[model samples]
Target: MPGTALIVIDMLNTYDHKDAEALVTSVRKALPGIRTLIGRARASDSPVIYVNDNFGQWRSHHGELLQAALAGHHRDLVEPIVPDEDSLFIVKARHSIFFETPLAYLLGQLGIERLVLCGQVTEQCVLYSALDAHIRHFEVIVPPDGLAHIDPALADAALQMMQRNMAATVCATDDITLDATPPVAEPDAAAG
Candidate 1:
């Protein structure tokens, strides 16, 4: 078990809208594992974060997007997994959550060691966040079933790149088990 933060990225309805109905199936596949991770995070008192794109909307907040998306019928595919009031939500203007957001600062404040990233568009926002996390030197893990992409081909490439180039430990969700013990990653060693 790692001193992990469950970082759910861009699992919003708007991004899923770009794909056909089949995307809902893909997203559905990831939800169970994500939900399990969330439960484990809560049990361990680990922070749960939702890092979402604001869709380049200059004045939009994460809650507003989540509310509007969940308010509609077509949002059935993703609404249930939306962040709750207790979860930390960061509205990002770019692909990388740490780019212009207070994600780094928040993680620092929480004393997080490893980051378990899961969410939508595995080739885009999730990939960028994983790379950024690797650069930040946070032990990054992306459970296979915890992520999805609009295009399967692109998703494969991104996963490979993250493993080979970015140094991410890409494992299947079933292979991981959460424990209450904190990770032994030398406290705050990744803050640089």
Candidate 2:
């Protein structure tokens, strides 16, 4: 049967950017919600895929990224949600998870038809990733409370666009359900 995958985007951050402080603050608030979603996804046998930024390092891998992020200032946020041994990790150089990455192909191989998007920068990476997922014919679901954003207004606008333009289901973390069943056909394909 088709399944749902929880895509955790850019949570393994070094917090070394200009808006790092603001992002960290927002991420701190969203940590618990993200953690809950991760736990639920694991319990439901849904795949937990960490799609993280490579921080401009072309040779960098998941182990290095995890170590750097955990050693950096945001250890509190990164430690609680570290990927397990069975989890999948993909490093991306761009904002979208599917941008020049094998994420779409991997999802296809795993038989994932729906994505539960969580993690940092709701306005940027998360939004772009959701759009790509929608265009690829995958169901998109974003948990607002489980996402971190540098700006509140922009984040809200991004979420609205994901809902209205991409037909993504913008839900709260508590309401999301990851199961083994495939997604039902959306009422309107144009929306997603």
lDDT of each: 0.78, 0.91
Residue 165 alpha-carbon offset, candidate 1, angstroms:
1.1
lDDT (Cα, tens digit) per residue for candidate 1, span 1-192: 445788888777653354746667778888888887877777767778998877667688876778766764457656567676678988888888789899998887766768888887798888999889999988888887988777888999999999998888889877765544353346575786
| Residue-level lDDT for 175 in candidate 2 | 93
lDDT measured at residue 142 in model 2 versus the true structure, 0 to 100:
97
- Measured by TM-score, how close is model 2 to the native structure? 0.92
Error of 1 at 159 (Å): 0.9
- Model 1: ten consecutive residues of lowest lDDT: 176-185
| Alpha-carbon deviation at 21 in model 1, angstroms | 3.6
Q: What's each prediction's clash count?
A: 1, 0
lDDT of 2 by residue, 89-166 (tens): 999989999999999888877779999999989999999999999999999999999999999999999999999999
